[model samples]
Target: MHRYANPSRFIRIADTIFPWAGGIMITAFAIGLYLALLKSPADYQQSEMVRIMYIHVPAAWMALFTYAFMALSSAAVLIWKHPIALLSAKAAAPIGASFTVICLATGSLWGKPMWGTWWVWDARLTSVLILLFLYLGYIALINAFDETERGGKAASLLALVGAVNLPIIKYSVDWWNTLHQPASVFRLDGPAIHPDMLWPLIIMAIAFKMFLLTTLVTRIKSELIAARVQNVQRSLHGNLADGRG
Candidate 1:
């Protein structure tokens, strides 16, 4: 991992993954949407409205997955001091936040019709909301310092601390009586959903995962290039100061 920390090498690897990720994401989304929107049967209970799960569930999954990825990256930065780890965490924050917003918004939309409200302070809902705040807070804390290293370290530490919330969010539906349904898609016995709906949901999840890969690679490369340019600018300024003296 440290060997690939070289910006040029990492960019080369990213270039390879970018096109492939984009292609898979597009293809998966096309199939996933076709099945989810047109082919799958309407739920007996929620009817056509349950189709929203195709989007909402995948977004919710990605929200949690992205945060877990960030937490792991933060751990790398703090323990092994992986040069690219902080950059990866920084790159992922906004994407994860976007997923969280989608989850919350879709949940509210689904809730209004199903649960008779636009919002609720239920355990799962509240925990996921806190996850959004964690992402936003991490972003704010990182930018608060002029020194990038200091900011990254501080944010990394915050990410580590915030990780405790992940498990809480995952189990909130079971841990307490919440309006949210308990695990159905991922259960020890097996998925509770029928095959017609399950297939589309799985494909949509693949699309979302590919989307993350594509965006993360692009953002990390951008971060590396920006850092390189900043280094060059600082060097030039230092040289000018010495020449003047």
Candidate 2:
């Protein structure tokens, strides 16, 4: 892990993994969509509308998962001051924000038919909203300082602080009387969802994960290139100053 902190090494590693990730991402999405739309039976209660879960539930899962990843990366930044850690946390923000948006939008679409409302202030919903805000806030804070290191430090602290919302989001349905349902896929006993519905959902979740990994690696590579360019400029400037002196 530490060996790949150097941007060049990381880029090579990313290049190696990206092709496989891309192939898997495409395959998963196609198969998952077919299963989700054509093969899976409609919910007895929600009917065809239940198909929204194929998108909504996974988006919600990614929203929480991304935040948790950011928090861990932020911790790595603070403890080890690794450039990859900082870049990874920064790279993950927009992706997480996009997932949060999808979750909220799909949830609203699902809710309208199921709950007779477009939105509600339920515990899970509210906590997930806070997670979205935290992502935006971290992005803003990271870019606020002109000094990159300072900005990273500030954003890292904010990420660590914001991690509290993750658990709240996870257990919101359990802890409160909420519009959201409790866990179905993961539980003490086993999955509540039938294997028929579960397979497509799992496949879609894998697709989402693969997509995120590919995008994050690309973003980190971009950041590394920008940083390299900045360093070259600084070195050139220093050489010119020495020559003049």
Best by TM-score: 1
Candidate 1: where are CA atoms >4 Å away? none
lDDT for residue 215 in candidate 2, whole number 0-100: 91
Off by over 4 Å in 2: 242-245
lDDT tens digits, residues 1-245, model 2? 68879888899988988999999999999999999999999999888997899989889889889889999999999999988899899999999999999999999988888899999999999998899999999999998986667899999999999999998998899999998999999899999998889999999999999988999889888888888898999999999999999
In model 2, how large is the Cα lDDT of residue 152? 98
* Alpha-carbon lDDT, every model: 0.95, 0.92
- Candidate 1 achieves a global lDDT of 0.95
What is candidate 1's lDDT per residue for 157-217, written digit by digit as tens?
A: 9999999999999999999999899999888999999999999999999999999999999
TM-scores, each model vs. reference = 0.98, 0.96
Most accurate candidate by lDDT: 1
